[model samples]
Target: MAKIAFILLCHKDPEGIIRQAERLTAVGDCMSIHFDASAPKSEYDRIRKALDGNPNVTFARRRVRCGWGEWSLVQATLHAVEAAVSAFPGATHFYMLSGDCMAIKSAEYAHDFLDSADIDYIESFDFFGSDWIKTGIKEERLIYRHLFNERSNKRLFYGAMELQKRLGWRRKIPADLQVMIGSQWWCLRRRTIEWVLDFTRKRKDVMRFFRTTWIPDETFFQTIVRHVVPDAEIRSRTLTFLMFSDYGMPVTFYNDHYDLLLAQDFLFARKVSPEARELKRRLGVLYASEGTEFRISNEGQRLYRFVTDRGREGRRYAPRFWEAEASLGRERELLIVICKKWHVARRLAGIVRQELDLPVIEYLFDEGKTELPDLGGIQSTIEKRTRHRRALMRMLFDYHKTDRLLVCMDPRNFELLQDFCADRATTRLLEIQCRFCDDYLTGHAKRIGLAGEQAGPEAMARLLPTIRNDLRHESDRIADAGFAHLNRMRETAGPDENAVPLAAFLSIPEDKARAIAAMENLFSD
Candidate 1:
């Protein structure tokens, strides 16, 4: 039997939460509990009490106030995922479930069922082409722009999106994203979880776009996994049965669902009301086969293999070829500017996107020093990153035509880029050997609420010279701009960044009588 960890993210239904947590832990399963910060402190304390002294349980230290249709929901989910991966790094799989979801299958059966299957189960669909929901639902959730700052501002988001649509303000999804909609809950492998976390950490454009969309929880995971995970065969079936309303809210399970839940072989069911004690007890009796053992024969193996042949192909195929082929036809000449970290990537991507009107991609080659959750290691971490990138190497390699680079030589990455981009051209690289200016201008502008805001053309014209490279072939185009202002500074105000003159240069730091002559050997004579 495979070891699986369940990530339970919930705000309400504390009774159901504690009940499920107790039941799952009673068997051999562990849990990562993230009680919504907005929930009553007593509710959280009660869950903690039930889980107290359980070595397998890991509580999310960073409690988040999760909004229903906001990115905060995704954030709370990620927090639970972070805790699970931290606690059980070698877990076979992670099943994301709500507080109401209870397993009907026995632990042995669930493990055997999962062990028999070879693919991930994600109930997904092309939102625009779905027949279950009306066309208007697609336009409302996917087409219109909905901005939300918190949970209570749902009415404001709705009204604003309506007004924007009336004003003909088109909310366009980026060309790179092939939007797919599906259930927010699904089971994924450990590798898939790590990949999703790592990919989201790098690709913030996807995150930023979804942060403003409605019910992003339903679309974000599907979109990322379908597009990025090469050749992943997503079974269009959810393990849990969820009945939804016309407005997309799940209906709570009642006693009537007993027969329906048993009719199907679904492993789990959701939205079980706290008062449905009879239904819960009946479910427990019906599936009271927890300690039972099961067996499979050669006939069963043959049938399973035949049914899952398509997924078997994925384990052998290098499916990044599909992503590469799709990327080759993209019209957007995206400039993927590499930074040493995500902060610098964001700062540089903002400047480059505005200055040249380029479709910008800011990517960090290495991660360090941030509040985001990440495992620690310098060399080993980078080595793992290199391997992960190599998995998507075809798509990454194909972007070389329009990829721009900004590299730091502070302590040098020591041929990491060469190892990563060994087959791609490196001539257009812009290496900067100076102090970073994030704290200088960007930080100040951010405090004034101009974070990632574009500078106007007139301001861009002035800033280009100060920022553009002296190593580029196009460097001459802006050469006379910044230096002229610098020369005017000499005549009007000061000498340099250090602000020391040649007369007193020796007084600052020199071994000889004059600093200019003392550094003569250091000059390009």
Candidate 2:
């Protein structure tokens, strides 16, 4: 059997360490854990106690304080590697493990792949060459100055630039050169591990590079390995246990995408939720029996089943209506109205104000809303709700009353509104698929008496006469479009003459005569 030395860097969550150890025991010949000294006393004791009797496990002597952009993590890792090398002298490979990482594949399979590949699996990118990095320097310098004192300030400022310059100093490799960066969580041959430790010790410049660098944990191994063995067999990508979140917080795999994970070539994944008892049970069964046909009953409902067939690709088709609805509701205030004419918007605004009893603001992009203006003649469509729209929506939602209704010219214009209203259980939404002219006609007619006397004559006339001709034109267009849509629906609808067209019920303009004819057409199709 190929001996594997598993080295884990743990801080909090002692149970997580135990779980990781248990998983590693299935594949690794030995395990060593290094606890951060700055961690709470209770956590340190718990971690020590959990791995107490494990013959393959040993606790490191030194404790280190780790921080973001700090050198401590790299120091701790290096310490653990040296300890592992001394204790497990004959181990074939050294594998880095994290407290939060969990093995997703069988230990034997993982070991065989590592052994066969004989590679490092760290990913290294030229960070200094990135455009974002260039732009960030000035801002990062300002932050460093603001956060650090005079002595520390100069050190960090010059150190950062020096690091950037050094990173920029990479030479084009010969055509035959096959340099590669490995994954941080990786299995390395003992020889490769020894080389890395030795390289770090002998290279004083490398130590200085890490001592002055931000995010040394990520940079140190990446820099040293690249410097030592340019053609090292470092795997481009591998499946390993990693927490999805920055903090490596535990979470339940409640997403539909969980099924797709089983097909991935990765051998590990992380931070499983303790509450996922059903998932645990199913996984346990599959792990023990190597049988995929494991089902779990939740509240008498057969919630999910795992099947072992190699070809069984998990396919689940269920629309997340609630999720979609909630997302829509959250986006309520981020809507913009675009129309060809200003008079049409005024008239529509009047109707919205009267019917919905809400504030309506006319917006112009150039003029910008003094109170709340519509997007300045930029065609308002669903696509407008990008980052700019999010900010605009937040402003509008914050300023406007919750019960207020927003009017947009078309369904596309109302996309943001639809999304915003989707989650609001308390807010009622009425989507009108009418053109600018039709909107004017509705608004004008609603306010004007049959005898042509206006209830609010001055306000009504301002919108009416300007919108009248356009309203007549739009009404005809809407009628034609509505009929065309209805005709298509008639061809596919079920055999029920009494079934009314959804658009017709929503007061969408359709040819009344064609609609009547289509009533019989419903069943005939």
Candidate 3:
């Protein structure tokens, strides 16, 4: 088995951090930790004392004062990764995580999964309307230069930013670099982390550019992964479960969310607050228990049902006819299945939901009165003004303020999403969809001459004699004219047609815009 090193970036909750470290030690996992530099030295001493003299645990000397969405988050993360690499230089794998995150599975199961995975577990996709941020917010994040951190006076900063955007300061990201952003947490090999650090160090321009970009943590590392390790063994998914509130804050999980947490095939979950007494008690019980299998107690099920019943009362979407004191919160990340027909979009959405481990918000533009899909027995589709384009704009731009991954399932909704790509350039879009990994692995087993009549998780686990991997590399399609710039970029095309020009977003005349798009071959394939 490959030795694993865990790197954690934490801000608050020293007790939680120590407990997690203890759990890792119990499971024979080594850890390297970095506390937020802003945390007082006394706090650091306390933390060090808790884990003192544990041969397996090491601490990063260079602590970083992290502010969310700032360059410092990336700085802190890099520091932790560097410390881990230094301490466990020979470790085969490094699992990067946040302090709030806790493993749901036993250490053995977690290690087994990592051993089974032949690729780095990091999700990266094209940025600029490509799944970086929620629709309305993407333009602000990817296009406009973010000069101020969260600590700066917000009102003055945003007002100045808007003025700057009007004055042509909001430039499109550079063409030489393709911005790929995804979940910040990832599990990668030593070589991968080394390459990322080395690549960024050499490319100070990319590093500095990211410093001025909003939420560099979400973009910096991911962009490096695409540019430096584009062809490296990598799968586009984080094996951790983190539920975010409508406004993108991590939701503090309680006993109700316990069942939901266990249901997903994730190794870790985040923000399990110590304040929630019942939740803390349940988690303690969970930690005390052993084995790889995740089973909910009868009491857990009852609590879950009670929570869901109350939760169902708060609808996730509101197109019409539902009074509420407040609107229902949406999933932090939504997998938008974009296709022409309702049926095609519907079918693809189900598969995507199961495979991607995210909620399906079907965004269909050209349904032409076809009945919205029932998704019967596979996975229920949440009808969020889905079959119409205007409704989609409203939901994405108006009400729900959550990040979205738009998937162009077929060529039909391609044009509509293309227009969106022109406007919200950072909304992540996926052209290729994989079936549920578990299901895919099973069928894959038969093709690989494995003796698995029934390809279940366990059956495939037994067949894990060698991780016969067949995940894709550079295998997504560019069908939209709005995304032609990305194609030119991947081709390493010279000067022209390389990136979305800043002028494209500035209100140029229609004919001039057409000429620019034509010049970039945006309208063409």
lDDT of 1 at 92: 81
- Quick one: ranking by TM-score, best first? 3, 1, 2
Evaluate all candidate structures by whole-model CA lDDT and list the values in order: 0.57, 0.49, 0.58
Kindly provide the TM-score of model 2 when superposed on the true structure, using C-alpha atoms.
Answer: 0.49
lDDT of 3 by residue, 217-248 (tens): 77787778777665557787787777665465
Please provide, for model 1 over 323-375, each residue's C-alpha lDDT reduced to its tens digit, 9 standing for 90 to 100: 22333222321122222223443553354445444444333334432221232
Model 3 lowest lDDT segment of ten:
320-329
* Predicted structure with the largest lDDT when compared to the true one: 3
TM-score quality measure for candidate 1: 0.52
Tell me which of candidates 2 and 3 scores higher on lDDT: 3
1-525: candidate 2 lDDT, tens digit per residue: 568788888787777667667556644468878888888978888877877777777767687876554677778888888888888887887777776554554555555667676667665554444332322332233112122222446686566556655676422322332223234666667877888888777767556544644445654676566555545576545356342222333333533323333333565555455555454444433333332421111111011121111123222212245334333243243223334344444554464356436566554232233344464432253334322443444445555645333533332223333333344422232222223344445453554321132223433344355445544444344344322222112223332421233223323334432343243322210
- What is the model-wide C-alpha lDDT for candidate 1? 0.57
- Model 2 residue runs over 4 Å out of place are 26-28, 49-52, 130-184, 241-260, 274-491, 494-525
CA lDDT of 383 in candidate 2? Answer: 33
